[model samples]
Target: MGKSPDIIKDTSETLKPVSGRGITVMQGWYDKNIKACHVTLWDLGETDDNFSDDDAEGVTLSVQVTIFSQEDEVELAREIKSLMKADGFSFEGRNGDDSEPEDGIYMKAQRFSKFYESEE
Candidate 1:
């Protein structure tokens, strides 16, 4: 087993990646009145060998994005944080897990615990 994959973001340290790749963020901009809010999400990227393009018996790692708010930044942040908890999100399988999609790769939503930030 690896790290428990429980992530809690406090500072930039908690969201940095171990390797020098890049932190993938699913985000959007929302404008309400005079305030323009930006929503960003950070999570783990999983690579499952079991997942293949065949779509028969494959399980890959991926992420899911759902808008939680369009009003206040506080509400938006709250919704984004709620999504970070994977509430409505269930990990039953992949998109085409029930049928074959000519590919053998699949992606599932998973959480990560640790990350590394550069001291620049």
Candidate 2:
């Protein structure tokens, strides 16, 4: 099974017509350099006992998504949510609180959970 960030990035690329600048792993204050709708990905954590056997392995990953935009991010967020669900990623929930904008860049944080398994 893939890690949170890797999985999210792969899924994001599958979405079409996304106006965002790009999808990439979240780095500290990196959004400040980008001037478009940019999505940042981070790993919150993984489930316990993710390994079942030598040939079977599973992981429930918590992926943190942050949307950086100068305008409202609602539509973009909704598209992302729909695409993620359509791709079989579970929607755990989002942060009740939001982060303050930095340099006219507004941000919204959402958390998504997904379970993956691989058999060797």
Q: Which candidate number maximizes TM-score? A: 2
lDDT of 1 by residue, 61-89 (tens): 33433222223223433333444344323
State the lDDT of candidate 2 residue by residue for 1-120, as single tens digits: 343335555555545446344444343334567776677777677774354554436666677777777876787788878877887788877765344655666777777777767433
lDDT of each: 0.31, 0.65
Clashing pairs in 2: none
Residue 9 alpha-carbon offset, candidate 1, angstroms: 23
Q: Output the lDDT of residue 93, model 2.
A: 78
In model 1, where do residues sit more than 4 Å from their true spots? 1-35, 41-43, 49-56, 60-74, 81-120
Q: Against the correct fold, how does model 1 do in TM-score?
A: 0.23
